[model samples]
Target chain A: MTGTELKNVKVLAANIRIDILKMLEKRGYGHLGGSLSIADLMAVLYGKQLRYDAKNPDWDERDMIVLSKGHAGPGWYCALANCGFFDKEWLYTLNEGGTRLPSHPDRTKTPGVDMTTGSLGQGTSTACGMAQGLKLKGSEQYVYLIVGDGELNEGQCWEAFQYIAAKKLNNCIVIIDDNKKQLDGYTKDILNPFSYEEKMKAFGFDTQVVPGNDVEAIDEAINRAKAVKDSAVCIILDNIKGSGVKYAEELMANHSVKFNTEEMVNKNHAAIAELEAFVKGAE
Target chain B: MFTLDHERKMGKRELRITVADAVNELMDADKSVLFLESDLAGASGSGKIQKAHPEQYIQVGIAEANMMGMAAGLSAVGFKPYTHTFGPFATRRVFDQVFLSGAYAHNTINIFGSDPGFTVGPNGGTHTTWEDVALMRTIPGAVVCDAADDVQLTWIVKEFAKSEGIHYVRANRKAVRNVYAEGSTFEMGKGNIVKEGKDVLVIAAGQLVSDALDCAEKLEAEGISVEVVDMFCIKPLDKELIIKEAAGKKAVVTFENHSVIGGLGSAVAETLLEAGVSVKFKRHGVEDRFGQVGTADFLQKEFKLTSADLENTIKGVLL
Candidate 1:
């Protein structure tokens, strides 16, 4: 990748992190854990990798992205708003009644969303279908899908993974946000999806593991996968939930924590301030 | 001895031949038009289309859910995909995929749910989908169509090809009476009034339209002038016509080869209630029960989904 492009991805990743913080701060409570984990990846995709036009979100030739772990849509909504798919002002409306930006990304309502996916593993299967369809039509556009590591426990995801590899959909890229924690608790204690990389590879995908927060490494892997032809590639991103915010990261119950107390609100604000300073210093 | 034109023009034998022919024609014209089957191509008589257009046809090997997802994916990238399976599998087996990927996502797909109701005959209750219409109608934005005969099937196939969004066209493999003449046009959500009467209105859908017409003829002998309506589109129903007919009629009888709960009967009831038409009504269908293995004729008799049953229901309501 070019130096300029690499620099752009880094900046975009940081911006996405900031966007996530701002959105969470506005909501006062949301799925910060999973959403923060995939922020950098979303930055890399929306910022540098994905070939999509914000002006024409419905462009037939545009690359498709399906957020299988749709609960992390706060991060995606932030990414979409930053990328100009819709106004950034709409980010505060997340999960509110009558808001186009629902808790889950709805394709009909959202500007850049390709499919409405909230039902765990169903999105991955839908992404596989989109990729296969692109291949059948001989379209060069690719399909990028993000699934939560914990969400892989869903049988539908494996079913989709099998089909994607079986079809040899080279135009598809699957990124699993390995945040370890699910709704109730950690993934290992609940239902361990032992080794995602090995499992995907066995299912015939060209699999790789990367630090989800490292935008450069994720971009390089995606570039390498894009270079390959006639093979499905999966990148299992090892990430910590609420990586950017120190307090949110430390708190176990912050997966969908509501900032009810003044102290909790102050802690969230402090985390956002720290992230902003870190991003400004990096620039 | 069946000529291609003769088969196409005829109503009873038309459904099997015309659908297969239309699919073949679509394949020839647009390379993007694809047909996916779930091991029932031979039974549905779509094997010829598959053979001639092998590249356009996908045999998914009995995995109905997988086929549904695959079809959705194909549609995502501009391919107009049509999936064929028996009514039971099409409506119930992979309902979630059909609901999300096809209907909810607004994918351009047409599902040919063949062997609806007692049409599967010897294949029995396991294969016959008495509740397919009810199941399909519940899906939002899903257009459910049951063609009366082959003529309507041919027209529906042609129209479906040009139309966009999710459409479920229920077809019976069994032969039935042809009602429409050649060049007769039918819209997606409009009902066709076959025989007009002032006494009562008989609203029916699918193969039951034939039975409704027959009931109308029988009812005429008893001095009850019953109007027969072919309520083809179950979802986005022809409310205006239904209300207009129901308002003037003494009573209304709804006949369908599906469950009375969410099928044509329910739709008619909802429409009538909304319009505030206080007409006495009787519903003749599968009375909230699962079907058993039997011949098509036998099952129809067992389920009371015949002209005689419909006439009796109408007469009983009148009494």
Candidate 2:
């Protein structure tokens, strides 16, 4: 919460947003929507909150983070690269064959990934297990799991939530990226999660709803969660699918935008340029 | 040759007690060893282990899927988690969790699928898991073994402690003949040749090993000269031993307290086919059928997984 640390987080967040745009632009088409939505949250976590060392990513005492909504891995990969877990040049290898940066984060391949997660609700259960294990071993390291709001439609998520609360795993933190969109359309049109906070509170979690794009707010909530002594914390992040770039944010299906022509690629570059200019101006 | 009193004086310990006692000893020795039960501790005869090691025992309600995932997580952070549940739930209900979390993810979690096959008895078809062995064997990189008796159970627990990755140990709740000696050595992927012969080979695992041994004895009296091999490890099968036995013998009869499709019989068949050994083979087990309610003895008889049935199958195959 220091002024200098606050500035670092904002800079990291802006850089992460730029990285997501560049990766998507390189891939020609990818999950720009949901991935961009989580950039600020990832910045807050990787920059100031989560206890991790990029140099020793496998440090046994490091805090664990599970990206349950693994399609948003570009956002996580960007943060990891920015944090020096691996070279930022490796970002272009996203979704490429023979590359360690897979579409879904593989724990063995990625330095900072704690669990290999892609099958939706299962990762939360894994996070719960890690948290419980740490508590059993009397380790102070925490586990942070991020699940897409639409991904909460899976019954297994609820099952994991109940177990986390039942075990009273105060060391575990769950963040639901409420971008409100999924593969088909909006979550409410698909399967509504109703109220993320109320549902999590019912399952015995200390619930918080915060503006997902605000790094300061995200960091404050995470600090509050760290201070909580008894209950597991659930943060419902209210975020837009494509939060930074103008063209991508305006598109309807930014989840996996198809940039077929040279014109589309140029447009994406222009939008990224605008974001870069705005970031530099703020600094 | 032995009278009823002489048989009673043999003083062999029951298999269920042996398994429970071994688990209890292990829990007492290792604090990192945890036992998660799905409300079957009393039936599995491991209530003592749970009672003595309450700190290490977790009763995860009756949710088998959740329990499997939880055990995987525990294994990820260095706890040796042993989840005990009935065979049906342990194999069928939570198979994905076992496949992905335990095997594919390479977690060293041991699953005790107790009361395998018709060993559940009057607990009936609903509880009997004749296909559990087949189901577990289908998972890649899974070490599936069914302990023949109390001695094998002790060896299996010890072996599993030294080994890594996922292991599914099928436990028969009913008491069976004690085949191995008190201090007999057991290997995970090596089969024990109980009775050596030249005419035919009898391959079996779990409770059916005793039936094959009895059949081998019966066949010996009739001058059939049968060899009985205890194929304990079903997955990563000892293909070299199987091929050697198959090449030496004219025919092979496989027995298991499971379905003939994908259990010990199929494992032997697959190995023989791959080795290009043209030995005649027959299987004695549940012939792709579900089980019914009865006593363990009665169900074994009903399912045709008995000494007489195995003997007939062996004789027919050899002839």
Q: Residues A218-274, candidate 2: write the lDDT tens digits.
A: 988988888888888888899888886667677777788877888888887887787
TM-score of 1: 0.91
Residue A59 Cα positional deviation in candidate 1, in Å, after optimal superposition: 4.3
Tell me the tens digit of each residue's lDDT in model 1 across A42-118.
Answer: 88888778899999998878888889899988889988988898998899888789999998888889999988877
Estimate every model's Cα lDDT from 0 to 1: 0.82, 0.81
Question: Candidate 1: lDDT of A83?
Answer: 88
Q: Is the docking of candidate 2 incorrect, acceptable, medium or high quality?
A: medium
Worst 10 residues of 1 chain A by lDDT: A6-15
Model 2 lDDT per residue over B219-312, tens place: 8898898988888888778899999887768898888989888888888888888889998888778987887899998998888888898888
Using all chains and alpha carbons, the TM-scores for the candidates as numbered come to 0.91, 0.93
Residue B31 in model 1: lDDT: 93
Query: How many angstroms is residue A225 displaced in model 2 relative to the true structure, after the best TM-score fit?
Result: 1.5
